[model samples]
Target: MKSEYLRITGGTPLEGTVRAAGAKNAITKLLV
Candidate 1:
């Protein structure tokens, strides 16, 4: 599995890079 960096913002003025899976990975996991 691979990870991606996501920029989070808007909530509580959050600003940082978060480690996350790709959309495909998320959807695949959900399907499974």
Candidate 2:
């Protein structure tokens, strides 16, 4: 058997007016 690793980093250095909108019937599903 062997070993594994995962690394993740960094997001969003934002400096401004940001607007976001979603739908009326928004559905999200995630499976792992």
Candidate 3:
């Protein structure tokens, strides 16, 4: 079986507070 990815491709502004498990800083660094 194959895996699929959740992709968001478009020109727009995403505004909101996204909370996840663990440190928030870690998530930001991962994005960078």
Better of 1 and 2 by lDDT: 1
How does model 1 fare in lDDT?
0.47
TM-score, per-candidate, Cα-based = 0.29, 0.20, 0.32
RMSD of each: 8.0, 12.8, 10.0
Model 3, residue 5: distance off in Å is: 22
Query: Which candidate has the highest lDDT of all?
Result: 3
Worst 10 residues of 1 by lDDT: 13-22
Please report the TM-score between candidate 3 and the true structure: 0.32
Please report, as a residue range, the 10-residue window in candidate 3 with the lowest summed lDDT: 1-10
Order the candidates by lDDT, highest first: 3, 1, 2
lDDT of each: 0.47, 0.31, 0.56
The residue pairs in collision within model 3 are none
Q: Write the per-residue lDDT of candidate 1 for residues 1-32, one digit (tens) a residue.
A: 86643343355664554334446456445434
State the number of backbone clashes in model 2. Answer: 0
Residue 21 error for model 2, in Å? 35
* Residue 9 Cα positional deviation in candidate 2, in Å, after optimal superposition: 0.9
Taking the tens digit of each residue's C-alpha lDDT, what string does model 3 give over 1-32? Answer: 86433344568876765564556566565545
> TM-score of the candidate numbered 2?
0.20
Per-residue lDDT of 13 in model 3: 71
